[model samples]
Target: MDRLDIIREDETLEDLQINGFSVIQKKEGFRFGMDAVLLANFAKLKKRDEVVDLCSGTGIIPFVIMAKNSISKITGVEIQDEMVEMANRTARYNNVNDKAYFVNGDLKDKDLIKTLGKVDVVTVNPPYKLKDSGLINLDDRNSIARHEICCTLKDVVEAASILLKDKGRFYMVHRPERIADIICEMRSYNIEPKLIKIVHPSIKKRANLILIEGQKNGGKFLKWDTALYVYDENGQYTEDMNRIYYKRDDDNE
Candidate 1:
């Protein structure tokens, strides 16, 4: 039997398009969004560096980063068993199983931490809402992915700090409202906030998402890039946004 044929009825392969990579996505459960793409784009990865992605739902960050950069290895740590299997299957489908692997374990587990070891970079798209702060999703999978039921903001930051080597970068995408808390968590864990970029729907709209990069045991200077507008007045994707999602190489050069 062919490997592609093993895809379940509830799952479908979606093309990333930018780098000719495809990921298996479920029909109803937690799905990768533009935030994953933005986080991958926001992260700066080296060709020979090791990377670990925490809360790697379906391993979108790993897949997208591997597609765009020539990284040595990437391990996606996910608590969800189904998502871990799907991420591993995606590595097989992309013929990058040796370079990209998925591990099923909670980020806070000490044994899991030992299994991960240290890495040059840690990227995460963690649950944005506090456990009881917002309207929780009825679906268990969605709920865990959206709310901090299993792990809170501090948990994610600390995990990243523990996994990253000195001066290693930690990249994340989160709700703009949590910027203050996010920065505080990073600093408390000794991960210095180095860069931040705001994502806005349009020029006139308030920002909704923020991309941040912190370095473990690094300096205190924080650099803010120009605000990124997803759409223009005409409602079409901005050229900058287009380059991030589609024309990745155009900006890499």
Candidate 2:
């Protein structure tokens, strides 16, 4: 299919700057952000592992992982049919459809979850705000992407637990304020928190985002990695942030 034929008038194709990969995104809707990028980077996957990404907006997490790792296969589960169609087209346009794809299904659906079966890894960049906690977006797409209108934190953790194989890994990026709730939900589903990393806007500011890695049916020990700062005192991207974005030669760092 022609790349131009797949993108709608309201959408644009954005380059991921890795392996010539690009994703189709709505111009005004919920586009992929640094939080998604950070979670993709935080996840460590084996070469032969299969992955399922829940709440996979525009399939960015799967594309990022595919670009960085030679995983067996990766599928993105998105509730929005528009996003899923666009993501699948993006995958075909990039000529990686055989190994990467998106499904238009809700992560909370029991039948859909059963169809997905078990996977080696699961990743999610779920909605960070509670349904009624913040001012909901006027657009339905943006509202569902930013708030827990379709699924809550517990829903996300439960879906991940069901999708993962024994000793499989689960990775997520969420607001730091919900750390306690996140841990509780993961443990309740038998997903033990293994690693935690805090992301700050700058050295002087408090953490705004948190990245967590959990293993299904694993040990209870949890390790804290060094905090990541997005910007320096002068409001410039930090070296670590630059590395994550592949701005330097040491991108693997």
Q: What are the Cα lDDT values of the candidates?
A: 0.91, 0.91
Q: On residues 48-128, what C-alpha lDDT tens digit does candidate 2 reach at each position?
A: 999999999889899988888899999999999988888898888888999998999888897898798899999999999
Off by over 4 Å in 1: 135-139, 247-253
Residue pairs with clashing backbones, model 2: none
* Residue pairs with backbone atoms closer than 3 Å in model 1 (clashes): none
Q: Superposing every Cα of model 1 onto the true structure, what RMSD results?
A: 3.1
